[model samples]
Target chain A: MRSAADAAEPAPPVRSRPGGRTARIRTQVLDAVTAELAEHGYDGLSMDAVAARAGVHRATVYRRWQEVGGLLADLFDAAGNQRWDPRDTGSLHGDLAALNHEIQDSFTEQPSLAMALIAASFRSEEAARALRRLWDERYTQSEIIVERAIQRGELPSDVDARALLIAATAPLYHHLVLLRTPPDPHLPELAATTATLAAGAGAFTR
Target chain B: MRSAADAAEPAPPVRSRPGGRTARIRTQVLDAVTAELAEHGYDGLSMDAVAARAGVHRATVYRRWQEVGGLLADLFDAAGNQRWDPRDTGSLHGDLAALNHEIQDSFTEQPSLAMALIAASFRSEEAARALRRLWDERYTQSEIIVERAIQRGELPSDVDARALLIAATAPLYHHLVLLRTPPDPHLPELAATTATLAAGAGAFTR
Candidate 1:
């Protein structure tokens, strides 16, 4: 019988020609890192294991990334830059609900990877830098939703966009990470509504 | 010179007779565990290290707690039951600000232990259970503040107390754990005010 770990092995990396050979290698290596993280978590992750899983030479992994933190930083950069895109749904509530849904889905679908990244951010400076960069990028992009809402007169002009955005997603994160609760189906709607109401009331001003 | 790790070594457990020998041993063992966690985190925590630090025999440590999770559960039980008491400041704003202050202090004062416990909760069933239990206890007690506010006509009776409480503290935890940012001195006040505003506006209503 296949072990649960083996069954959960990440699918082999897709060979892409977008950036040529170097990009393909990078993609392969990162996919392997993701798989390793899912299976063994940050503590059990090792360069040798990632290389072996990626079918790349250990020296190649070492020469490029230098260490686990560097590799993870690159992974965060790639994931954040490539995956997260701002939504302009014409209304702040719709846009926030969409964003909340995405955040909830990420946590629910890739719990191990999410938890590992969160833990690594706390434990490693490199990971922390990478995670911060990712959040900064995402937050910057998403702020437009609030900006549009302000222009549309849906929210106060002085509303703190970042604070509103963070408040919308904080409860879900607090429940998932700190409370260890299962995903609540109502969370996205609740977060969006609460954020909207708070913004309207000037709770996020300044 | 002693390294930073060695200098940060947890102080020896205090001898106490308030709860008798078994209770004293439990206290000593838990204190040692907290120290070990602070120094090395959950990944590096070992029963042998805990026993050594607690000045208890390995057999004793093994015989009682059985594993790290068991030890952590007991610690959570003790800490949750003894430490987190709800404040009755006659107003939701005052109570929430006090609660946020405590959460912020926990993260600021003992980051290592807090991060370790959080990471452990993500990685282990035992830790998750303990974490959930701790949250449940705290949320249940703190909900009374919202309940009282409703009676006092300060908030809508339909407001979701747990959601309000979680939202108030989520951003602080997000900044601390995910962004790895330095603590903002104003976080407690901001959290309390945001929560109070949102609750008053019925954003947290079910």
Candidate 2:
């Protein structure tokens, strides 16, 4: 029988790469953690378990992440930085629709990332800090789009850009995490509708 | 030293009282758990810590919630079920504004509930399930307002009621959770702006 300590030791490298073996191993372990999180959740997550899953030593995980919360923060940063550059769709509606499509795909395609980050936020201060970091990044990124709309006169000069952005995607998370439903196809439309409303509301103008 | 086995024992009677001393203990423990969550966040929360805080036996906390996940679920349920009977403001905007105010207060005042649940979700399947249950209750409650508007003919008959309801509250959560911002004081004005947009978009009619 394996003692908890045995599961926690560091292991030899998994993939031999020409450059940055350390980075590669880190990626592999984080990937393993993400998979385990999708399957087992946070309580089930352990350095020992992650080590076994990643084929890395428990010591390796501990060395890299320092703690489970630290490991998750790195994973969340990687996930949040997953990209979708905005296209010049010429119309606010078109750009918003495109943006919403990208988000919908992100949510539908890689649910584990969302689930894991959300789960971590509840249990770890480190995870909360990491999550808040991602949240800020997201807000900043989305604001750029809304600001462009304002400049283009597709939106009011006084539009509540932050409010518009929140109205757009908040429901999807709400549905996935809270309501336990796959977000509806019409969600993007509703989001666009809300953004357009906020843009024209001129709340920011006052 | 307290072994895990010892912690697993069924709780003894906490005290003889009306409303079942066990139930009172349960409530006390739950309140302690909630307070701990609010003060320290999920990572800082521990069953032993919660027991110590509540002045109850560690066995009592474990027996009631079963695990950190169970404790979170019960807390999630309690907070989510904090009900508000909607007042008839005789207009869609008025009703929505009022609802948004209540929601803003709920999350802003008790941010720990959100933080704990998110952290727990990372670690426990049961916590995720509990979160979803609480959310379902909120979604259903919010929908009632939309239905009321429809019944009153303040909006067209053919609106996507579900979408409308989601639109109304999703932004509130988005600001709280994602943006980490306290909602604007003029939330009613914001809601009114949305109602105006909905009316013009013929979101319900079309």
Candidate 3:
């Protein structure tokens, strides 16, 4: 649970949102949860600890989240909302490269959190469902990248957009999770290039 | 920890080895560890449980392994020795297909064990090293597939054999671990074909 994140420099403060009291409290709780997860991992997380860390009443946390799984689901929902916008970069390759870079940055900035969440998903069905929903949201949002590419004749009309996106990101996850190593610096570029080549060759086509 | 492996059929008995008493004890202990891991995962595993299951003395288990990490390392070593042999199938595509099929079959046959090991690796440094060593041995064994292709001029001499192997297997892991879904039956074929196309295009070459 406690690993490199314990030794690495602290992350920057969570940004203040222009919101009312309830919204502000929610943000504080979520921020505390993130820090707890990064330091102790999902298995070590506790509502009492989160409440103490957030300086909120334990009753408030109990009333709001009810359990760890509910809190995790809310966290994932917030993450989905805050996900990097994959803008149109003029071509499929450029768009995929941008997405891969964003993924790589997320992993680099929060390796322990990323690994903890993955481990949690395997241990808990609730966490797995939350993760699946999070990925589904991201996948749906990013499909526009391939859709636009198809319209521009950059990819085959029959290409499976979701499959293509998975192809681009799968190797990075493989390296981080299975190989238990930091991905190569060039991994994003290689993933983009490989997915682009495979797509162009109709390997991703239904 | 205790999940599908609890309900699924019991694994077949370990075969008797033609060796001394020490070897027989080692085999029994290893077999007990596998069954324990498959049922309770690494986190829930206890030396007492393994010793009781193996019908060996607790003192013997402690004297041999000393800790869960040592037991895991020994389990991984036994797994490496029993790993599926990836034969040369003449063509790179055929060889890759065979390898993917084996990976897919392993996952399908023992989903709980696969997931438990993955989760264990994240939680313990010793498990991570053991898993890495297991993969390294498998990757080294499978390198002959790409090497033969290079010799036949079917792949570029500069193609990275390990990277290609990783690419072919990455998506399946992504589907199983990240997506939390059963992989498509055609995934092995798709993975092999996509990797073949990408490697042919030099996407895996340095």
Q: Would you estimate the TM-scores of all the predictions? A: 0.87, 0.69, 0.88
Query: Whole-model Cα lDDT per candidate?
Result: 0.74, 0.62, 0.75
Error of 3 at B18 (Å): 6.2
Q: Sorted by DockQ, highest first, which candidate order results?
A: 3, 1, 2
Output the better candidate (1/3) by DockQ: 3
Evaluated against the true structure, the overall lDDT of model 3 is: 0.75
Q: lDDT tens string, model 1, B70-186?
A: 887777666565533566888889988887776666666753566667766756688778777776776787778888888988988788888888887788777876666788988
Model 1 residue B164 CA deviation in Å: 1.5
| Tens digits of lDDT, candidate 3, A63-133 | 99998887776766666555345768899988888887766655667546766666667666677787787
Candidate with top lDDT is 3
Complex DockQ per candidate: 0.63, 0.34, 0.72
Cα lDDT for residue A105, candidate 1? 66
lDDT of 2 at A84: 29
Write candidate 2's Cα lDDT for B1-206 as tens digits.
Answer: 01101111222222223476777776677667767776777667789888898888998778777788788777665555454346567777787777677666656554435544554554567866777666666556666666777788767676766666666666666666554555677764575556546554665445
The CAPRI quality class of candidate 1 comes to medium
How many clashing residue pairs, candidate 1? 0
Better-scoring candidate (DockQ), 2 or 3: 3
